[model samples]
Target: MSIELNEADLVSVSVGGAIAHPGFPGLPAEPYRLAADGTPFLLPTFGGIVYNVSVGDRAFGWAADCIHPGVSIKGADDLKNRGLNVFSCLGNTAVVMTGQAQGAKGVVTGKSGRFSEQVIVHFPVEVRRKMAVGDQIVVRALGTGMEIRGHAAVACKGLSPSLLKALPKKVEDGVLKIGVVATVPAHLVGAGAGLTSEGGSLHIQTTDRAEVEKAGLSSLRLGDVVAIENTDSRYNHGYLRGALGIGIVGQTDGPRAGYGPGLTVIMTAPKGELGSFAAPGTNIATLLALEP
Candidate 1:
């Protein structure tokens, strides 16, 4: 299916072009980084909310702590038509209102943010520097896909806030951090490959085995928001070709051989911030109360 923005991609944002919001902070004057390699790049964000598993259900070794940030830009009225919008929470309004992407425009498709950060806005390779964690871009909220897909959306056709609210609530970390969590040991993390729920499980990758042990594998339940660190991460974007969430797991082609693990971020703290808990094997540096 060749994706194209029809009316579905055309959320007007403003009722008739009056400007939906004054907007959060506009695009940054200078983004910290851009895709030097220049593949079909996407900024990672939290995939949105899910529920904690129960006796019949299980995280099944997935990153059971946090919500994957949606691949959002800013808010627009007709983004729902473009097949890009997904809504969850009263804060869905806050998402489009937060950064440089706010009021601006882009496609909010991939739900990233498990261990990754950045709202995973898929740009045309020209707009990378225009956005950053602090910068606000514009997003067109689209509708939800299917529940089996495990994503967030406002569209009545698929996963919506009701579905998001209805999930199990597997884990709870009262705090929410902004940036990615530190890496954990490869051995200690539970289980997640490159794809599941279209790569929704990407956030569980970690580089700290000790943190895994300390966090207590059993202590981890689905839907918990854990943080992660931003490293080379050994991830590949091509895996996402016609695929979503592939970047989260760093799935190049086969099984991840080196440091390919995911983490559940608790929240979004400010940049240069630290986490609040110290797991056994990871080097998170500090434990902070975060909000993302």
Candidate 2:
């Protein structure tokens, strides 16, 4: 799975200012409450490296929006958005190029959202402490021009060669089997719809307790790989029967109208792109030998 790309595919970006938490002003005067007696508060949305938490934790915070650290690039048009979101791969190196934490390094974890064109980066606690709003963070985007040896139909997006190599893949009979912790139904897919494969995430709808329980989505852990049925994530998120998308659970959020746990797209293809199979035990945590 070693992939080679020309210099033309690589790009860099400057970090935009941290997005301030703009409270939904139109809501009722009473503080938003969760589970009736739960804490009443406002939603904490985007920006900053959220430390002390990782995947697999319960989305228990009151009014917590996207529960992940994010960095955005302002004034990004369609082309720049694609370059930052599509070309950038998970596990790519991110370096703080300006401010007090200059020279600090981190890893690209996932993309935030289409509207913001933000990229999530994970740095050490100390490094994050030194970072501030608008601090320049440069990423070595390198996932473009990738192909899975003989599987041309199986499109690879936002995944590094090393990640592909580490992913638990096998050929059984004539079909390629990709291990996944769960198989999510298309109907349960929420949020991130209509977004491009570049730097975007698909939210698992957890508002329906039955659906969540039936899909076994409650057991999903951060970094766990999951397969989404009827999802064509090659370009934009779309509905195409029999299409399959394999993604990593990147972030979690409390109950929202149309959002839930966030999944970052790693590999995807249309129907018949490749023989698809799923099973538990395959996840980025296991592949990278990191604790979940």
lDDT for each of the candidates?
A: 0.27, 0.66
TM-scores of all predicted structures: 0.25, 0.79
RMSD of each: 18.5, 4.4
Task: Name the TM-score of candidate 2.
Answer: 0.79
Clashing pairs in 2: none
Count of clashes, each model: 110, 0
Distance from true location, Cα of 239 in model 1, Å: 20
- In terms of lDDT, the best-performing candidate is 2
| lDDT of model 2, residue 240 | 88
Cα deviation of 58 in candidate 2 (Å)? 5.1
Error of 2 at 131 (Å): 2.2
Q: Write candidate 2's Cα lDDT for 163-243 as tens digits.
A: 777776776564455778888789988888887676678888777777788888776766677888899988888888978
